[model samples]
Target: MTALPGPVSPPPRLLMGPGPISAYPSVLRAMSSELVGQYDPFMTATMTETQELYRQVWGTANEATLLVDGTSRAGIEAALISLIRPGDRVLVPVFGRFGHLLAEIAERALGEVHTIEVPWGQVFPVSAIEEAVVRVKPHLLALVQGDTSTTMLQPLEDIGALCARHGVLFYSDATASLGGNPFEADAWGLDAATAGLQKCLSGPSGSAPVTLSERAVEVIGGRRRIEAGIREEGDEDAPDFIRSNYFDLGMILDYWGPRRLNHHTEATSMLYGARECARLMLIEGRDAVMARHRLHGEAMLAGVQGLGLVVFGDVAHKMTNVVAVEIPEGVDGDAARSAMLADFGIEIGTSFGPLHGRVWRIGTMGYNARKDAVLTTLACLEAVLRRHGASVPSGGGVDAALDVYAGAGA
Candidate 1:
């Protein structure tokens, strides 16, 4: 028989990657809280409170904000599968890997998908998306607010108003941008937005926080259907039922709403963690958290540049949470990344598709977004680069980062 694995003792790692980074300690403590009955009064009350906290996080007054018991991708599927009906024209602006993910999910929903592509490192201009909207006349425009693959933040401020003008529903996957960056769900006129706790929320990847505008709620409401075993006398299922049962937002909303309808058993510990993540964000103030991320992000960017590393993508459009730097010409990117992990216990990221083996992604967000974290990552990265025979100036990385903190008086 194979030997049983010993009690799970994973090696300590500083996740400076694009995602699945270090979760906040308070969040981990909350996740360890004892479980309770799903329908218990305390559980229901906590659920309601979590909803309220997320409203502040999303900057929305939408009544349908809630947690989906899965990763951020699950939240995206829930929104896409529920809102997009068969043959509905959906326009997707593809900038990076996540944009393709959105288009793929929409296709699985049987929507007539149309796409407008920009180069991997860039984002679509609002005028370009508006042109697509006019031509495709899509029922929904799905986009990603931040694509970590390229570390680019797509401008959403103008796109939402453009969608509204075109009478098109708008959805954005904000998994990588929400807490660390500025997101105004209501002010931006977004119909739906989804994010996971693992990124900017500084929590584990089990819960996805999602918010739907009233208009989005109405669209999802039209597709509601109670499962046969849970059906009530007055409940009416829709003729155009959502294709996916698990991803049906309408049923999920019912579970979170005042009716207290039973759906899946709540992931109790995850709910606790999710609540704490939101609670901490609200306590710090959203703008303050974004500022912290920005400060550290700038430091990291300066640090890498000072090490003579070429930064990837359009710097102006890069996300405040993550930055991608081109791998040196002669150094093996994967080997360098592995050395950083094994030697320093720091984990950076590799890019995807067109950027694969071309760039290394480093992140400064959530619990890891701090001056110390930025300085340490830069210091160790310089060591690793030098060991790999890449020319790196001594103290260049850390000094550049320190100068940034000094300039910010942080």
Candidate 2:
């Protein structure tokens, strides 16, 4: 038999891309700690603490706050599939790629999906969404809080009230904006919200933190079913069982709750990483972390513009975590990106769909959302663009970013 490869080792990289940014050191350390049994006291305590910490992160008092043992999309699916029944109407407002993902998941969940679209770079106004909700009269409104593809942040302040007025359940995927942007689940009246440990949370992407309101919990609890192996004599099943047993939130909740029923074996290491991510965020204070993102995000924006680059989309509605800039003429976009990665060990992102090949996405988020990271990316980008014969003023990018930091008293 052929011998296996040696122990794993990854190349060093300064991840300045849109997501999967560098995780915080504490989170990594937490993940490397010893493992415990699923229902052990230490393991359960860690889980409970994680839920409470995420409650602060999500700005909710939800008792159902917990982690889904998968990526951010898994959390999105769990929330949608549990809340939606066959033939129940769901309204989705699409602004970018993730919106389409939500719609597709809803359709798979047997929801009568209705979608309203705006151009990729724009977000829907309160009036427009309300108009659709009133006309469609959907049972649920599934939307993305922040779409990294277009770097647009849909405002939820008014949409929540609109959903309540029309008796529609409100749900949002906050995977990209949860830690770095301002998101108040309780104040925004969100019935359900889901997020990931990656992006602004400054951790890896396996676990997803989810919060559900009392109304949403009631809806899901109505469809609860006990697993056959663990079912008691008094257990009763709903007529229409949740389509996917693995994605069922009802049974998952029982495992998280006092009953401590066994479902799938909890992903213990991921839970530790997720817990540490939330703990660090709560320690730093949510508003402060958001302010930090704003500071560095603005620096990156100003720096790119100083390099004679034009930014894409409506800047007024841009998220504080990522920015998309137009690729200049006479520059081979792919070649410049390759040079940046190969020469500088730095990684930036490329756009998708209509914006693909037209723009480059620069992210200031998570562990990389800092003045040094932004300045380094800007300096390297300027060098890369200059090498490609693009007209970039010498020292312009770094100077402009420094000015922003100076103005912010950083």
Candidate 3:
């Protein structure tokens, strides 16, 4: 007889990895809210509210702030495809995997992509990026603000000014850093920026929150096209319309803007979750949330170093949400990771490309960036290390973390 599977259930896990960390409890509840018809007045109101909330989150006055109904990468694709016409020159500075991803996406958009690279564990200096910008004379500068692969946060403060000076449009993928780290889209002079809710926003990865400045809007507006079935009497489609229908930001903006033109039926549940994520961020106050992440992040750093683990990357420029620790000699990295899941129910992460199997990435972000979470992970990690025959100091991790909290009067 064929047996049917039961209701799905996942094991309890402390997600202390680079992303997709444990979501905030309220966000989970928000997703389960009952749905409404896509064009229902209530649904539209919620959509408008979500847009306004994300404006505060992105620190932008741009009217194009809204959600892209997919993961973080969807936002990146939408921005790139909409902004880059075929044969447009695009410059990307590669410091990690995601920078390479930006370049690849640009290539697919029929762009003439040029990339300047630094080593895996480092970030490019603003001068080097400017030098590339001067040479390439690109139409757009695409960059990744916080790349988890190398645990590096590229400094964007000056890069935007460099782009402005060069008359190049600036875009950044802030998926891994947005909520937990400090990001000011308007203040930083970013023409466009995108992020997902999964990382520091404490929500599942489905909806992507995006914002665009007036300059970006003007560029995308030139490529607007209404589909055949949706064409109205006065509608005029551009000759060089955006290539991908799903990723056309112009059409998306019309749908999300005052026109409220229907593009596709919105993802209702994901919208609810995304709204709650931004609501929580605003209610807690941005400065307070940033400080919380910083506090917990420092504690985790102190804890890991106290265990005598050598951290990878330039610590000074590391993102406040995640850190990369070198795998001790004689330790089977994959085996230890498996044991952490099997024995302790904690999930850290493995590196990619050059750092694969060489370092473990530990994250202190979102809901899991609490004092208890940090201490528990450090204690369990110390136990796991001892069981794997690695010499570890007794109570070293926890004590060090506690000292950090105590000194901060937390």
lDDT of each: 0.92, 0.91, 0.92
Q: Name every residue pair that clashes in candidate 2.
A: none
Model 1 TM-score, all chains together = 0.96
List runs of model 1 lying over 4 Å from the truth.
Answer: 225-239
TM-scores, in order shown?
A: 0.96, 0.96, 0.96
Ranking by lDDT: 1, 3, 2
Error of 3 at 108 (Å): 0.3
Give candidate 3 regions above 4 Å deviation: 225-241
- Ten-residue stretch with the least lDDT total in model 1: 223-232
- Tens digits of lDDT, candidate 2, 17-71: 8898999999999999999999899999988998899999999999999999999
